[model samples]
Target chain A: MKNFEQRLQRLEYLADRIKEPDLPIEEAMKVFEEGMTLSKGLRKELESLQGKVEMITNGPDDQGGPDMVPFQEVKE
Target chain B: MHLKKPHVDAIVIAMGFPAKEKAAADSSPLLTVSELTSLIKGNLEASFPDVTVEGEISNAKLASSGHFYFSLKDENSIIQAVMFKSKLAALGFAPSDGLRVRAHGAISVYAQRGQYQLIVQSLRKAGTGDILAMLEERKRLLASQGYFDAERKKALPRFPGRVAIVTSPTGAAIHDILNVLGRRNSAIDIVILPAPVQGAEAAPAIAKRIEQANRLDIADVIVVCRGGGSLEDLLPFSETVVVKAIAASRIPVISAVGHEIDWALSDFAADLRAPTPSAAAELVAESREVLLRELDQFQAVLESTMRSKLDALGASLEVFSPELVKARFEILSLPIVNRLDDAHEALVNSIKGLLADLDHWIALACSIIETASPQAVLKRGFSIVRRVGKTQAVSASAGQAAASRGGNEIVRSSTGLEPGEHLHISFAEGSALADVREVNE
Candidate 1:
């Protein structure tokens, strides 16, 4: 898990690094591919998180009403 | 008198010389068919400015030399017509029997046949629908092949390096194209490759010039154009040769054939099609003012881009300066020192643990020494005594008595008996060496 997290962080860093102008074109292309992977992974995680929240919100409520607030108001 | 003069009554009834006067008054000249036809021809020419006659084309024959002889007939009337080969070939479509046509010319008599005929200067469909029918199939074929597709059409050069114009040298189209191009972009080179544009050989000549220009790589783009004319006059431009030449050209071809409403095959095949030659030149070459404005914009963009690049480079240089690097190192040094201090504490703890182990070993050594010490031997009732002048032990009782009498004395002292040394005798009560006895060795 820690190794995956480290790899994810490194990929994000590389994505940001490729934004710099002087990067070699070949390396930048590789960075773009990696960035795409990271972006896809992050989107998948976000979608899953959203799905979980949706499931919880739709589950066994006293009534299906707009009266209740969803998850925490803030996250770090 | 009435009966006898019945025959003479007729003579009497008629007045003298009255019959002769009536005959003279009724006198008139007679005319033949040829004379009347000449008169009608003269009259019709004076009466009508131009006449169009609709009829079915029949008895059509083109002579081996260079003349066309055909007849135009309606349901009842038939009239002979003649079109010389030069004009017949220029007609584009062949005139044939049963084809309905409207002939534009004057009515006149051919003296040889003594027949009235139409000397047709031009001919076209009597109705507009036939033209549409003729063009439909071609349009469908070209459309299916994607020749008329907007996506396949090339975007005309924004600024052509050099423009080569293919048009008739003597026509108004060349003048119009040159005038527009000159007004729009005077700096652009305009090379005109003159072609006939309207005769039997026009299509092939135009196609050849296009191929020549393409092979020579003379122009960045080409404009094939001619002035507007009647549909038949524009047919040369619509020929398959011209269309294929346009399609095959490597350089972009702009075709401006006729007026806006007139579309030809060349227009479909061209990379860019304009309504007129002047418009085509305008499309490929921009107005001088628009070009100047674009140049100004490009200059501004170039200056701004270079400035931004330089600024970014300078900013990066400042960020990577040695002083900044040193400052960054100093900022991070404290944490590294703190980490090192933590490591030092760990090492000190380990050293303290080793010292504690050494202290335990020292305590064990002390205990062992206590067990093996001479003081322990003393506690065990073991004693070491020395003779007066020698390290000898007095053990047996008789030996101790004998030593006391002669040369040795028994003593319970740290010293032992020695030769020529005096010693005090000590026993359970007392012992002493009183005399010396010489014993056998």
Candidate 2:
């Protein structure tokens, strides 16, 4: 799936181009509506993130040795 | 306290350079003890002047006056050295026992103590071949291969949706990177490729992670980081494997190792070098945060832009309305209306002038009428005459005056009336019948 960054970049680009001084008010309104819609949708998607930090585990011989190392914060 | 030995007083005058028994008084040109001491001091100073000697230091101490006193010695020989406060302050590194260094100064004698010493001017580390040089050499060798070339450095994506952190799982670097990523934006997918960042395995492990991230295409960028440590601990970051791995990464690699002073070879090879692990996380996450901020700004711009457009439309709409046309018509007609008022006032004044002229003409006409009217003659006792029954034009011939239709007409001339003809005569006050009029002739 195309990531949110690309979508967000496209939305930002449309928003920028819509601000041209010479653009007709009618056309500007149309673009503004699209940008606002995209922003709302993208923000909603970002807020509803479901994935957490998933440790990749190997199957079969799940010895669980030092294969996948869990992150630790060294205070130094 | 160690006891001072008395063997020095026991003599050695026989063993001294003079050899008193062999040299007769006239043959040796007998010299005083002070003269002998001065001669020895001058010869020693001249012979060993401006010499550079390398030795390990011992009994190093700094006095209250900031002078450094130490003994420079090797296995067999020992020399007392003193560096005054000025030169000691200029020494970049600290001095202590067991540190080997080269001391450069003139060998001079302290006449008061009667002891010879090295007045050390400058001291430097005796580093003919050490880690500092080894590291530099490795860096130079790698750099020659364009491993650290600016052209080889890849530009990081402006908004990386996926990131892989290549660092010790047991290190603060991973936590810092994840914390920064989560705080700025959790939308990015983080793949923590755990690896050692210290010890012998650190270099190879870090290299493996970078290769894995590239092969799997698991991330848009890779971050290699470790906490601050001594040069010995951070050595892995400078290893050829780590440096070469960073240089060969398909995805941009960011190296953040140790504190401000610690620069790993990986730093030079990576796309960007951050001074600290936390700083590296901040640097990599900065673009996404910037994007978010810019998105908010553009949203505001979009709103304001739409609002202004609507406002402008409303303003332009008002221009074409009936009320505006009416208002404009009133404004446009103002000067014409004012001009007409002025003209009306001028017309009234001119009419008044014409009326005044008419009043003068009327007086003249009234005087002429007064002169022609018979009322003035009547007042002067004059009488008017008319034919009794003529209303038609008065007969010019006197003979036809009797044949006229019956209407009163005045006899205009005396020739129209005979002396015996009946005629109506009227004074200004009354009428009478009588008429004897004779032609004046």
Candidate 3:
């Protein structure tokens, strides 16, 4: 029932938390499960927007484009 | 008071004059034991620099001044050791009784009580009860130079294109990593940067792998790992060279050496530290089931979201459908429609006006053409007499004089020719050829 943006944010937080070194096993598993849910949601959104997919080159800032790229040969 | 006894013994002493002469020589200006001890202490201080001693700590106490007073003992003997507050602060771990320690400091005698003791400058716990103690020491030393700060830790790529593993190729560590990676995710390209994991070559070889990985740009993230070991076996990870190599790596490094309880200095310095080889592999590549489930869930959510939006828009469209509101729309647009009809009528009227103007212009053009017609000129009794075999009109003008003078010309001249050679005459009624004998004007 979570909105896409909200769910994606939660997933990113879960990813970050689980990525820590000393995270407790139980907490990590919880995060892993939550991250799974969030990741699934995000992936669904990504695939749905596949037709509108534009190659986004991550830079130091948020300046990205949905335009031509050499590596854009990757299929949807 | 002893002269009587001395006099009786003197006779006996007189027999040993040589012994008496030796005694006199030995008794001349001899030093007291205290002075001699002081002289030896001064000389010891002047000769030897500070040295380290490894022994078990006993009778340890922290004084009010924060200086530590402890006695270091071997099995047979013990020596007094005092570490001043300044030096004691540098100790990463707390010092306690019965703990074996390696203390570095100068050996000096207490001048007041005259006891030789080791003045500890620094102390480190020896013999590895907690490997983390030594690791903490090394970690502190390296961390102060910014080796393990969170800011320096690199983030691992979500979907790494290539992963280079710096571990023993023969050991279970690599097998575990490879097995996990293959089982979890086989999409990544892996390169084995095999290196020794024990003995003298281990640290250097591990460092070499890190360097080679960087040089080749072979991987997005490098996993420097090995199996668990004792404190001695794990020393390679604690080496400055290996930790520095991990710190200096161009690619992000994942340290997966030793078991969860066994932490090496490289663990702190690396971009990330996995508890074990298999754990590191799992970190690098999530389980296939998880990824697939994630993808499926994402697909469903995305579909549902997009579908909901579409449905909502469709509902709104149905509520405001043009077909349902056509009568109302027509009524609302009645004024505009009437205006448009009036505009159309005006446009037609304007077009009719344009057509009338075009007709007037055409009639005027026809009248002008009729007035300028050559037949009209002929109706006005102006004949266009033309020459035979030529399209030029015969006229009484000066330019036609040459044709008029020619007697055998295709058209006859109005004046008679006084020539017997040839003559031609032409009028509106007919054309004739005649000969003239006499001159005529």
Candidate 4:
């Protein structure tokens, strides 16, 4: 998640840089390509995200850490 | 004690039973206190086996054994009531002094005290009005401590990697949250920290689960939620423990208790108050479609900006291209080229005039030379003569003969000429040999 946010920030920055009036064409093109790649990767990641549901067990493990297991909804 | 005797008779009369008449005392056998008390206890227990009484509670106390002891009172009367630990545990809200409640229980006589009391099996707030007033007082107290201060609230993470929900495992809230979160963003991992969402035990259990979620530190945010319920059913969410737990959480909390109209103290203490469990999930998880759309917008902006930049660059390049440069260069160098062309024409004309003058001079010189040259004179029928015989010296022939052949010299005059000397003569077209008879100077 942190990486995703960072990537998004970087992409936005690139987009902003590309819009700078005085930027050289070569530099602008480089930034534009980077922005395009970052956006593509972010889109793919968002599309591929799979959700998972789990429940914390009633008691902690021997190490006093939480134990999680897939949650099954009991149907009435 | 005398006042209670008539009240006891009134209660027995209300139950459609005749009281033991003190007037029949002379004819009847004297009854012991235990016997009489046992009889009253049996009668009371049987008559009011299952009853619900609405009154204000006073002197409420929870014992160490978890029994709740209180008195239910109306404007004119009061009755002692005790809810054992088991039944007390099932209460939706805490029983407190000054709180009005409807107590459901059986009435039994305490023989030791020679009085009858209610054994409450369950309890609920008498009405919403008193509960709201109590809630208002609690809210003020908690507010004074800054439990609902905005400054203390932490901002929720934009993209939560994991969300731990503190709610009932079996409640509709859990299902709604899961459905909404899953539909919006499947990437978020959910961890259910199960707790009873109602009853007297709910408050502590919820607080404990929230604390436990913090201890685990596995989720980016904690969502405390429950489906809509009656005011009493949602009382636990307004409990001090639950509100304090939400305020104390290190992780940001989102409170989504009951429906949109239901407001719990937890909502105030939490970082964000969602109208419903589904809304809480929506707040915590970013929708994939919305994110993708935003990305698309960024991409479009990037593409369009780059296109225009390239187009502008291309336009500038066209200005510098050969054709355009040539056109501009022509405009700049036109005068210089015209001046060079004029200079070249003038130079060619002057050289031609100089060559003509030289040609004229050469022709004139040729005519002058023709007038003075020996060859030109010879062409005019002049003849010259030279001696062909041997002659060693002939100074007199200097002007007459230009060349000597063999031993012969030309005789300018007849001086030094011998009678036997042969002479060679030449005219413009012919030459002849002859003997000279005379040489006169």
Candidate with top TM-score is 4
**Tens digits of per-residue lDDT for model 2, B1-441:** 112122322232422554544343334444566765676677778878899999999999999888999999999999999999999888766667777889999998777677889999999867633877899999999999999999998888876666777777667777777777678665666667777788887788878778777776767888888887666778999999889888889999989997766778999999999988888777766766676676778788889988887888899899978989998988999899999999999999999999999998899899999988988888789876666532333333342343233355666676655555556655778556654555553
Scored by lDDT, the top model is 4
Model 4 spans with C-alpha error above 4 angstroms? A58-65, B1-126, B182-187, B284-286, B364-441
Ranking by lDDT: 4, 2, 3, 1
All candidates: DockQ:
0.01, 0.21, 0.03, 0.49
Off-target runs (Cα >4 Å) in candidate 1 are: A1-76, B1-133, B136-159, B287-441
lDDT of candidate 4 over B197-304, digit per residue (tens): 999989999998888888878788899999988788899999999999999999999999988877899999999999999898877776455667889999998999
Give the Å shift of residue B130 in candidate 1. 4.7
Model 3 lDDT per residue over B1-441, tens place: 445444423432443323443333335334476764676577656544578889999999999988889999999999998999888777766777767888888888887777878888888767674766666777788989997788988877554556777777677787777677666544555667657788898998888778767775667888888887666787898888999999899899999887776668889889988999899888766633354565565444544544554565578788578786897788889999999999999999999999999999999999999999867766776554433222233333422454456532443354644445334344444344344466545
Q: List per-candidate RMSD values in Å.
A: 27.8, 11.5, 24.7, 15.9
Candidate 1 structure, TM-score to reference: 0.39
Q: What is the fnat value (0 to 1) for candidate 1?
A: 0.00
The residue-level lDDT of candidate 3 at B353 comes to: 100
| Model 2 bad stretches (over 4 Å) | A45-51, A54-76, B1-129, B175-189, B285-288, B326-441
Candidates' C-alpha lDDT: 0.64, 0.75, 0.68, 0.83
Q: What is the CAPRI rating of model 3's predicted complex?
A: incorrect
Q: Give TM per candidate.
A: 0.39, 0.52, 0.41, 0.60
What i-RMS does every model get?
32.1, 5.6, 16.1, 2.6
Candidate 1 chain B least-lDDT 10 residues: B432-441
